[model samples]
Target: MKKFVALWLAATCSLALFSQGKPTTKPMYLSYGPTDGKNIIKFNLLGAAIRNYAFYGERMLSRKVSLILGCNFMPRGGVPYLENFTDDETLKTLEVGTFSFTPELRFYLASGYGGGFYIGPYYRFERFSLYQLSTTFDADEEEHTIDLDGSLKTHSGGIVLGCQWLVGSRKNIVLDWSILGIHGGISSGNFNGLTQETISPQDQEEIKEDIEDALDIPIIKSEVTVNDHSAHVKIKGPWAFIRGSFSIGYRF
Candidate 1:
């Protein structure tokens, strides 16, 4: 009877071991992928050949999801016509600078392969300083000089979406494409110095009187008084961009 009891116990233990599955272990960090222990970096060169010509620089942080910081420089030049006057034109030039910060979320399409996409929103703070020169050529020659030593400040927020295709997984040779939609509020302070010199005093008085009568405003008979103005400029809307580039980096 004792021998039979020992044999039954041994059979039960063998059945339990066979029915239970083998123990599972977690994957080691290094076995995951090349990016398991490192960061990524990128740079860009951009140019606009439109109303406003501009240049941009961008830096991206290293991580599963990264942060991007960038800056833009614009040198603007244009010839504008005055609606109040017929056949009158004004030529002007200005320089503007903008800085931006954004957080991005990366989606890995396939694990162990070095390719993914990202999307995010950004806040941009912009500063504008104008160094403008204007000239008007009419039957009677008139010259105006303007200097804007004061700086303009504004805020803009936007959304950006893009994708990246990496080549040679270990080397970090990535090609990226993206689109940006931006909008914001703007305000400007004028430190503008404007001076008007007519060909003759008679022409000066004639022009001054016409301006006053047309506008029905008080006339300052003096030759000139410094004019400074300040106002809020609205720059809210949707703007988009498409970019593609190749960058070399590393992932530890």
Candidate 2:
């Protein structure tokens, strides 16, 4: 009996020790910290260099998905890179202001939600305000100058192929590279030129031709009308744009 009791006690003690050594699984709750950041705010450095102000906010949705919202504004200023858009010297005098808003849904190929190679579908709305000064001829071949003011608006949607990486020891610095993005949509706007004196029919036609000649883009079309003292130009066309950016962000 004594021997049996001793063996039983030893077995019970062993079982208890084994239970203590084995780890019990506990439920884990995800919290925001250095390892896991849920939100990010980014600035477009390249855009700023071109006199464009752009910003973006991103939120992680899942292990492989996220959402982003971006905004950009360019104050009324001289057209940047005029040589690439047109060879017309009149366009060199053109000034414009631009504003755009974009929303995107991203799917990351790797495990990380906001960092890795990503492809996203995005929608954008953009508007441009145009201003220019031009000299035209009247019926008698006299010089007349006019100031034109107008706006153009476009809506487009496309896919964005990009990659993002987290660097630094704490992984708080982010680099986002957008490889290629293309979008197409319709655009329409009107420009009005006001002059102090009444406009003649011949001068109106000349003004119309001059304005149309300045827009060298093949996809765009314009219709012009003239009243007593003002000329109106209606612009309509299929508009397309490409997006590319290398943006820096802070994850928090």
Candidate 3:
């Protein structure tokens, strides 16, 4: 009886070991998480075409949520596409540079864990610098040229809607398109102009009037002060902007 019991116990131990080493035939369902691509870096192709260097970075917080940051810089040069919109002669000699930063939170509306349509709220802080700008205004029946320089800064918040797609064999390539974005906020700036020749009292007043007249828009207000050789402009305005971009990127 003792020998039989010993053999049975050994058999039971061997069977348990074999069962523990067996592989399951159950199907696998992969879920997107930290193990998959969870971060993306992108470049704005549309902005680059217009001389604006723009870049964006995104990180997934969950299956349907992400956080993003975008930055853009345009080198000092003539205003882009200004001639296409207006024939204003005064703007022909103006040059400007721009920089902006935006932060956003995106919520995706799709079935899968990857690319899809998304709507996000974003906040933007932007700045513009005007340099070496020259404009002529007639004072005392004489054409006088004033060299002007200034900077404008604004802060705004808005919502953007867009879609993204993951491409390539491993879905590591990302294409992002921002369909539409709208923002509105306040802007303030100051510009100063200097003339080579001395300004008469009458000419100073006339210069102030001319500056004010040019800025007489329903949505914005400005104040002008003129002295013997220089003129100053203070600007306060409500500003609005529309945002759009097409970008390509890689996921990691």
Candidate 4:
């Protein structure tokens, strides 16, 4: 009887010690700390006076790295005449598209406050098309058809620098701004459609004679050879963004 009682007491004491040591953690309630890195994705809708619809995609590469791609539709206006031409004709309306890719490095000055700066190199592609319309002569009463066989396209490459700030505790909202320098070439095919028309054969003969005389000048053929075709056009300017965005993020 004594042996059985001792065995029972030992079992009960072991059970009490195990039960009182620590409570098992419930799956329902859990807690975490800040400073944990998160994966961030944000989409932005953008617009400007020159551009209509613009969209952007940003993904976090790391805690301090990101990749961005953006595109925008620009409606080109104003008919600025080229300096080589004597005519005052200007380029009319046309659709322009711009695409950019940038890999950025972000520096966080403060952890919780969400203040940072970003700078990176970028590649930009821009395309523009010119359409020819009817031309009106200064003295002629009737208009003539202008044949524009195709359009001009330009490709540019440059670098971008920018900064950003976050508002609120959750870091759900952010403000961003940027500027870029773009440089490339503008390529336009030959302009062979410009021709003079006269009602009288005598006027045609006179114009032909003038052209022949102009060609007889002693200027070097290579120097006088006018080729408006360019493989690249230099585009350098400032690109800025003032935007507010919300982001959904995940932490591992």
lDDT of each: 0.42, 0.83, 0.85, 0.41
* Candidate 3 structure quality by residue, lDDT tens digits, 90-144: 7888899999999999988983343799999999999999986665656667888
Residue-level lDDT of model 2, residues 37-155, one tens digit each, is: 78888998889988999999999898778899999999999988888877876667789899999999999997465778999999999999989855465644676767788899998
In model 1, which runs have C-alpha deviations exceeding 4 angstroms? 1-37, 48-64, 74-89, 92-114, 133-142, 169-171, 185-191, 194-252
Candidate 2 lDDT trough over 10 residues, lowest sum: 24-33
TM-score order, best first, reads: 3, 2, 1, 4
Distance from true position, residue 201, model 1, in Å? 13
Better of 1 and 3 by TM-score: 3
lDDT of 4 by residue, 144-228 (tens): 3333333434444555555565544555455665533334433322222243444234433443343344336343121111112
TM-scores of the candidates are 0.48, 0.81, 0.82, 0.46
List residue ranges in candidate 4 displaced over 4 A. 1-46, 75-115, 133-141, 147-149, 180-182, 185-252
